[model samples]
Target: MTVRPITITGEPVLHRPTRPVTSFDEELRQLVADMFETMDLANGVGLAATQVGVDLRLFTYAFANDDDAPDRGVVINPRLVLGKISEEDPDRDEEAEGCLSVPGLSFPLKRAEQATVSYQDEDGVQRRFEAHGWFARVMQHETDHLDGKLYVDRLNKRWSAKARKAIKREGWGVPGNTWLPGRDEDPFGH
Candidate 1:
């Protein structure tokens, strides 16, 4: 599988909602394999089709829980169900999140602690499962990408301003722009 170049933020495909993947053919399988390879090369936990310039509703994720047990899968045309967060839960942490599109920048974003997602597998079989902690956050992040939303859009006013400034300073707001993760020098030192 080839590692496709990741489309940066401000690209039209990254801003617009993706189309559903209706065909589960060899092409779709190849795309999934390429996405996984690209994500691994970029050291990303999750990646959406839009991030790779494919306007299809699909994403791949590779995550390990606290015990180091691995979980990896592909979600096509996913429907996400978020669990309610308890205000009284002191253990809940607003962790910093980064995106493959908006590379080199991270912001502390609060996401649902748990979520259930329904999606089709590569073979077009239906599947549903729940995720928690960092895995849950990754699912929500990738789902946002499919819906034409970015983590920077969910940032608060203070962090939003910072993100905008960084984008402008780095000249990354141009449409159709892209950068290679390891090859390019990260402005934020990642």
Candidate 2:
């Protein structure tokens, strides 16, 4: 397993929609293994194929906890089955978010309250999981990467302005439309 370099915002590959994996054979399996190593090396909870220069619908993540236990996983050819928002969702936390691709930039953004997602494991097995709170947020963040979407694009105006300023001052590559302005709606099929 090797740690792959993450592609930043300016990379054209990051903007391309990922292709679905047609086979879960040895090569794909090895990529997943390497992805786990890379995610750990970068101190990230999740890493998507696109971020690592592979245009496939694959991602790996471990849930963050105080114990810092390893919960490494691979989601191959994952697809969204269901998603929704909650009434209890706190409106737009100013918590900073970082990306493996967009290194040196940690910006605050708004995300979903909860999410129920289904995806296939590396072994060709199917699984559906419900994630709320932080876990839900992680799921959404990773899912966005798969769809060629970044968290910075989802921020409200005020937060986005601050993030934009930071990127500019640092001479960082802040992709245009980094945050899609407006109220976010569910991106899942009913």
Please give the CA lDDT of all the candidate structures: 0.84, 0.68
Q: Model 1: clashing residue pairs?
A: none
Estimate the TM-score of every prediction: 0.89, 0.77
For residues 1-190, could you state the per-residue lDDT of candidate 1 as single tens digits? 8878888888989888999999999999999999998887788889999999999999999897652324888999999999885443222145788888988787777788888888999999988887888888888999999999999988777778988999888788788688665576653454
Top candidate on TM-score is: 1
- In candidate 1, stretches whose alpha carbon ends up further than 4 angstroms from where it belongs are 66-70, 85-94, 181-190
Best lDDT goes to which candidate? Answer: 1
Count backbone clashes in candidate 1: 0
Q: Which parts of model 2 are misplaced by more than 4 Å?
A: 64-70, 81-94, 169-190
Candidate 1: global Cα-lDDT? Answer: 0.84
- Root-mean-square deviation (CA) per prediction: 3.1, 9.1
